[model samples]
Target: MDKHAQKIAADLLHLRGQVLSKGDPVALPLVSSSMFHLPGDPEGAAAYGRVDNPTWDALEHSLSVLEDAPCVAFPSGMAAISAALFATLKAGQTLLIPSDGYYVTRLLSDRFLSQFGVRVVQRPILGFADGGFDGIDVAFIESPSNPGLDLCDIHAIATAVRKAGGTTIVDNTTMTPFGQRPLDLGVDMVVASDTKAPGGHSDLLMGHVATRNTALRDAVLDWRKMSGAIPAPHAAWLLHRGLETLDVRFDRMCQSAAIIAPALADHPAITAIRYPGLATDPAHALAKRQMSRFGFLIGLTLDTKDRAEAFITGCRYLRPATSFGGLHSSAERRARWGDDVAGGFVRLSVGCEPVDQLLADLMTSLDRLMSK
Candidate 1:
């Protein structure tokens, strides 16, 4: 089998040589012990739970295949992001972040980074290449940026950043590794809140960072160890369960978005829509070149925040959720979270469901929104 298929099999069956039993269980048996008997050879595999575990190893290997490099798993998405930040940036360095990404990311930069002596600056994702990377120590790019669905030119921007003695970190959560590979574009690191698509069931919280650069990979690994930001073996197994269906699930979700986005765009109650799958979207041309599949996330604007809330509340198929990439559709009023977006803006996560039923549910909700 090809590498991706092999990785998927590894995720699904967890078939490995280490399972010495006559017939290994299909799932990874979580190792719950905090410490293992190291004896005199502490250098072997299966170290303390904080540093290594078999469950994490299987999933990390699969992710490493997806990213074409080493992978480090974390307890939460922010933990992985924090590891990247703390690993690369020193007190005096400047961090250039996407102004349109997840709200908490902005919070981390503005509220958290400043206290450590690092300077934080915000820039929109669409024109990131022209943002001028000189004197910038780190640049964080979130293509198909959260809530905005804006795309960035990773190659051009990463090239500029490197020439200026800066590093580029791409948040690949929206697209997932199957959708885009930033390492191929010269990014120094790829990080994601695997809690979203990677943990598609929404029952687990996990994150990971992947890098082709050995030094950066080793640094992030060390940071994760020192910070104790490791995922529980059981949580890692749950992430593995969700990831087994990632390729199929992501495709269905993207397909759903392809239909839903244009339909929303045409609705009278909708003021605007941002989805790269639509040819008229500002990010379409660039996304077509950069992404393997247009992402599952959709952004639409209504007349008001109340109307947006009503629309989500009115939907039967789409759940009112702050998260994304599950089996059921969901949406949230992003501005309520203090994101610097339009008060009427909503971030919709397309889920895997029958196309007609999903489309009808959303359109009907909008009709109800208009009636009210």
Candidate 2:
């Protein structure tokens, strides 16, 4: 809450107005040219599409200011993470990943990075809560983790990892730069999928890595250049537009989830609830200490996969969608995606909908399930 402490709205407003010079469009101008004409020097910031773009630079600048670090944007969150891992680790190194975190990351580690000679170990997020980084070369954390919304002590783990001469990477997709700054918490690299709440709308796909270390930033940049995984100019611009209303969008969505998660938890059909925002939640205390907001996503488990499906299908207002953090509330059965959670597990992405209507939809849906 330093720079972002004050309303990030102002900075976003500045980005919209300043992306183009005086008498320019109020919105960030799209630089669509595949190649920019360089002077006789043959050296410039952006010579080709794979290299750079004005839209990307402006968006990165806005994101970096939030983290107070250097930032690199990529085509997707996975791309940014992939680049970060490839740029930092070499063959035959050890990597510690969260078993409760993003499954795709685990897939990349076990199915891809491992093939290249890296040792991949899947551990409970807090397996090293005490700074136990023995023989670990790299560690990744996703605070208020996905699907389950589990929280991890980032600062403690990062400190331990650094002491052990290992690198620390944090996926801040849930909390975002507004909700939390992982780099300030001692993490070496902060990665995010702007496709989620940051995009606000359900339309764009993008990601980025923010870091305080110049070497780490350059390495990630180099990997992105060589791999040719870059965000679309329009998508980047759309994301930046989404950023303008980020403070408002995130706050509204989180407010609704805060109300909705608790009521859903108390239902007889629900086996468990996992929203860090709730005081009754196990991660509430730690989240209060570490995160600016509890987050907009909620996790719940029904007695069976059938019941879970019934609940979602019965809802009047909530849409059944795979993604989270959109303008409309939606949910997906996590197990459908092959997550390790219970077959009845549901990941609800609360949106900027009227809270009363949302709560009623979920409650009524659950009531129908119980009756059946």
Candidate 3:
């Protein structure tokens, strides 16, 4: 097997290596590079709170295995992405981005980085055969993109962009490292909101960037050191705890999402549904080829915006909120989030709840919306 495939196998087998003590799992790794007294430890290394932390390093290592790429962790998803972007580009450089990328990422490119004379163009990223991605230094992509759940042809885009001497960075937040390994598909960098599935509880917010290129990896590490975007030790520890059960949690969540996505697709009140796993989705073929799992988020658009709001509000159990990959199934109108997502669109985050309960709740909520 190739090195990437070996890494994938090793990562999938990581849970088997957990040191079991008296039948209870240990919370921390057995080996740590902490402590200043070690003979080989670097001198004058007490470089403030942001440079390095043992807890964060462990999480980064664990996540690197999962992602099959060397990684760096940050306080939030945007921090990780921002550091990566800064490392890759400079003043007057241009990056081509999916028009439907995560809102905060678009904000960073348009609202913040624009001040530095860096330009971001939102190209049509849903399909392949490259019409919109011409002449860009970098391509920022999101498969099952935020709110829209639109899957781009990662390998296609990666191949075309690489031929043109452009780099590719994919936001792998929605699919998690377990479900989708972007690096294996030839992307230059993979960024995940460790705050989501990596943290799993919605209580902590963090981000990680995984990459194979040593120079880019070192650049991101240096950017993090300079920008002070490092994550808290405790938060890193919490994310590590979540990583152990990632395979288990995501398996259940994806199963539930598969059940609900089709039901929502066939519903009379729903006009559009975007789930790459669904056979009818435009990106289904690309998604099936690139991703191991279809993931848990589904974007469904109702006939009207009012109906979308009604369904979210009327759900007896589904919470109306931002953020996803938590333990409780939640639904929110994507357009309300200040993104360019269509107004009638609803984004559903499937949780670890029973598939039947989520489906029943969804059906009831749709009925309620139809009544309105």
Candidate 4:
């Protein structure tokens, strides 16, 4: 087995309560109390739940190992994003974000960050590596950007931003830390919506920011504590449970996507398809160089919104939903969410379903739509 896989297994298995205990619990014990009892000295012990929790510590430690840095957890992906932004940017500083990445990030910058006197700049993901970062204080990258599935050269972009004396952050939501580690690729910080793939199930919401910089990590932790954006102990426990099976689950999802994307590309109903796993995809070369796995997201376009809806409706396995990185296959038409894409474009999040079944379901849906 690979060393990383072995490390992950050991970390997760050891999360079971007290390795030195004579009889350790089969699972990590949930400490739900909001306050820890102070006998004499409260100096070293947890004082408040909002500021700290054992469950959160376990999850953060596991994530820190994977992310190769110290990490801070938050209630949701947006909270993490907001924390990273607030911790990094100051008034009159310039922030650069991917134009085609997750919409809410842009919304946050425009509606709120701009009011604080921060200059916001938008750039497409395709050629971002070569883009000029003059006067940019921070560059927010989203390679294999959400909805579009576009790729950017992380090392190149980070190198440029660093040369210009700016911080670089990558949203690694689509490709979990297992798939890609931006820090290893020269990025200063890595933020992700653990609510997506890391959570594995659609039931919980969480996010985290990981960085080698101790100061930044401390700032993020302070923001979470002061803003009360900390995740629930239960949610953190659930995420830790999800992380235990993430290796197997993520492998199956990627393998299924490898099979399904090609099959979808060949279908007459698909006008265009974008998946870094595909050799024909424009981003394949960079993805191969940077990512260990090609991930499970596929961007495909049908003829129109009606056809896309019909295709989704005809599929038995694909659930029409907004979120991705769940156990169940889900898809959504991006244009409906005001994305700058064709009305027919669909962002498909492949799941752990058997490849043959998933392929058959997708092809059957396309065939029926064509016949109609």
For lDDT, the strongest prediction is 4
Candidate 4's error at 108, in angstroms? 0.4
Writing each residue's lDDT as its tens digit, candidate 4 over 1-372 gives 257856765676565544557776777777788988879888998998888699999888878766778998888999999999999999999999988999999999999999999999998898675559889999999998988999989998999899999999999999987788899899989899998888888999999999999888888888888889989999999988888888788888998999899999999999999999999999999999999899999999999999999998889999999999999999999999999999999999999888898889999999998887
Instruction: Give a tens-digit lDDT track for model 2, residues 87-106.
Output: 88889899888888899999
TM-score of 3: 0.89
What tens digits encode model 1's per-residue C-alpha lDDT throughout 262-282?
A: 888999999988888899988
The local lDDT score (0 to 100) that residue 181 gets in candidate 4 is: 80
Which residue pairs does candidate 4 place in steric collision?
A: none
Which ten contiguous residues of candidate 4 have the minimum total lDDT?
11-20
Candidates 3 and 4 compared by lDDT, better number: 4
Best candidate according to TM-score: 4
Provide the lowest-lDDT 10-residue window in model 2. 1-10
Clashes by residue pair, model 3? none
Candidate 3: worst 10 consecutive residues by lDDT? 29-38
Please, what are the lDDT tens digits per residue for candidate 3 over residues 1-372? 235544554564464355455766546643333444435556756434566566776677787778867999988998889988999998888888777778788778888788898887876556533574556788888887787777777887898889888889999999886688789889999888888876788889899999999999999999998887878777887888888777778879998999999998988889888898899888888887888889999988887788888888888779898889988888888777777877888888999988898799889888776676
Q: Which stretches of candidate 4 lie over 4 Å from their true place?
A: 15-20
The whole-model C-alpha lDDT of candidate 4 against the native structure comes to: 0.90
Q: Between the candidate structures 2 and 3, which one is better when assessed by lDDT?
A: 2
Off by over 4 Å in 1: 1-22
User: What's the candidate order when arranged by decreasing TM-score?
Assistant: 4, 2, 1, 3
Better of 1 and 2 by TM-score: 2
* lDDT of residue 372 for candidate 1: 68
Candidate 3 residue spans exceeding 4 A from truth: 1-25, 29-41, 44-48, 127-129, 132-134
